[model samples]
Target: MPPQPSRRTFLQLTGVSAASVALGVSAPASADATPARPIPDGAFALGVASGDPRPDGFVLWTRLAPTPLATDGHGGMPSADVPVQYEVAEDSGFRRVVRRGLAIATPDLAHAVHPEVRGLQPGREYFYRFRVGNQLSPTGRTKTLPATGDSFSFATASCQAWYHGYFPAHRDIARRTPDAVFFLGDYIYEYGINAGDNLWREGVTVGPEHAVEIETLEQYRLRYGLFKSDPDLQAAHAAAPWFLVWDDHEVQNNYGAANSLYGVPPELFVHRRAVAYRAYYENLPFALDSLPDGPDGRIYRRYDVGSLARVHLLDTRQYRDPLPVDEADRLSEQRTIMGAEQERWLYDGLRGSRTPWNLVAGGVVLTAITDDRTEQWDGYPANRRRVLEAMGDAGTAVMLTGDIHRHVASELKLDFADPASRTVGVELVCSSIGSNGDGVDTDQYAKDWLQHPYVKLYNARRGYVHTTLTRSELTAEFVTFPYIQADANAQPNVVARFRTPAVDPRLEAL
Candidate 1:
């Protein structure tokens, strides 16, 4: 694959001239100054979102999906390009307008718009909205990371299968309004809906459009539409910016690199992956640099949130070796989860990081759970050790992860078998937003897994983790809901809290 384009290169290719787009303009012209068609009634049905925040600005996103569930995957948009106008303001009422621009919603991209807005003040809140003729999108709140600050906060969540339960966790996350949300994969499941599996939500069922597995580009786009149509999930996206990475479920379960779980050939799997990846990019608030190149994209990038923290978002599913079938294969020294390039990048970043808290966010768990080697860091022990050793008493290192559908707190040791091995860092695994139905507080798997001394706490429920990072310490809360399969009104509460002191990589219950 060729190297991805830089931000300026992408803008030039897309006809989005950064110089022409001005700030502090109350009203901007249409994309080409052409009279757009009459605005459709609910063009912003999927709602508005922002992501990939920088110190100076962030990306704003919206899709013209008047009918999100349309079978053709066009989202009820015209076959031609539609000009959409957007504005950024310092307040909710749009009185203090700052940045304004226009971006075309093309039919080829499912009428999606990603405006890479810049030239804004750092460490301050800004509100943004989109417009087309008389239609206006919901106002969304976003902020740039402080250039230098003493603190920051974020939430980690993943694995939200719409058919399993309601999105009460997302609703609560929206209410908390964290600075950013790290969505660690399983954004949308690839399985076809089954009535037998719809035992949760009473009187709720998947529509005909979602009754088949997603494979083609159109199908993947429609699947994303189905998930994004959820009111609770839409609210979460609108409330705060998100940083995303994908896992197997985004294409198919257990897919690694070019491998698929159903024994499909590598050549065929690549096509499916390309389509899924394209749809994923079109639906999120990702910067142009993250645009897909065939079956590959560059997602492993560093986000420096001032002097307080540095978040290294990783892409584990795209470059990892296939699942090991036997113990010898699992223990092979050549096995890698982050590929060679990403591994080198991560090591260099960790070694040269200047922030007080260094956060490595990925899609799967890092701590060893048991002898069973399946799909997490346990399957690639050699590479995991390399990463853990690179920290080497640097500033505080923390691993934020999702997947496994359970909340986990554990100590990251250089060697799991060696009890004397030093604790290099800590790993906090957030539970699913709504997967595996309404889960119990504890399960047989949790009982068997807690036998490991490094494993600290386990809660099997539907929720996310909220974290607060400061110069001195990092605090994390495992927030959970009583039930979500049947109760859309379920509320979230903190079930456990842990604190890790700076320079001391140990989890202490609070």
Candidate 2:
């Protein structure tokens, strides 16, 4: 067998201290000038992170602190700029360095820094590292999509509640090693845990010490810091760069426009939403194009992963009007979840897409959801129908959504009026990473909507979906784990596999 990676390599990979630290150390600074602060000294404390890769470039990210500490209420760090340097190598041994840069973590953005690096060769795996002074961060790995390729496979995942369980499924996701990971909303819920909450049999401790609803930027930062501390989550981020979108829990559960059922005033809700969005921007490895405008910001954008795909990342919450809850006779056409401009953008991209596939990254469950009480696509039939019509017009489209803590797959038909008719495209919804399972009734709820026969499989298992893509076909495998509270050695098996070949509408079981 080949020799194992050296302790130095392991330290580099795990973001542990490296030999370079000794060489970089300097004498203690004087108290009159800049006061010295303790640097992070362990592995993946703030969690490894990566995101949004173009054919020639990608974004790498991380926050300071061996712990997930953030700025105070004023968003000002009490310390000086943290010198964060990053190196990306084509070889795991880091034999050949492709890119290197320095990022300053400031208190204004909660010390979170995202360095957007470009000029990387397409369709390659690269390892990266962040270093401050002599202390090293966990080594993270990411890959670019194949440019002008026949096919590439990827997966969609979302909504992880730290207290709900474990992230065993994430281990399996790392093994599959897709070019990119698509995260659709609810990355971290702001909800307080309470005993006997039916949504979860038991609650896990999350957020800051105060268990109150997050409102200010400090509260939002605290919430994010709390989640970043999870080892499993940190490992997953280290494995690959993620394409992300937000859902309700990131701000408030079931919040739309200025309306919310949680009894928070609309103005207050908007205020909190702004804080949440800023914190999100601070935490993720996003392009500068994602910077917030004022407090209320837009999260919709598009990215291309080589020539393999063009992804449309949308913000369904910020622009949408209040979800309509009218009787059949009082239907209004003005209300929309995607709003007008965003919908137009999506349709135009779909119609104009030159790539082999068009992937939509958005929050909330968008497929065959039948609850009128919930504000999913199913609740707004007119909008859902319009999207389906557009999908039919847009050739070779595949949608991936997350919100529901379960796995579901189906071939979308232009007109669900006839289930056996032409298959317009396909959709795969992955389950939560460590979030609580939607009670035992999840299966029944899924099956009750069989009238929309486009649905192929709906499972309540807590796991993830893996997809492989080529120019001619796209194959997705739903990998389900036994339980979250399991060991890292645990592997999720291929619970179900489905494929959609190019030019063919029907999805076939593999």
lDDT of 2 at 313: 90
Model 2 lDDT tens row, 355-473: 77777777866676455644777655666677877777766778888787778887877766665667778888887876764223256567565556678877777877888877778
lDDT of 2 at 190: 78
Summed over model 1, clashes come to: 1
Backbone Cα, N, C clashes tallied per candidate: 1, 14
Least accurate 10 contiguous residues by lDDT in model 1: 18-27
Models 1 onward score TM values of 0.93, 0.86
lDDT (Cα, tens digit) per residue for candidate 1, span 401-507: 98999999998887878978988778999999988888999998987669888888899998999999989988999999998877679978899999988776788
List lDDT for all candidates, in order. Answer: 0.84, 0.69
Off by over 4 Å in 1: 1-30, 33-35
The superposed Cα distance between candidate 1 and the true structure at residue 26, in angstroms, equals: 17
RMSD of 2: 9.9
The candidate scoring highest on TM-score is: 1
* Model 2 misplaced regions, further than 4 Å: 1-44, 69-78, 194-210, 328-331, 371-374, 437-442, 485-490
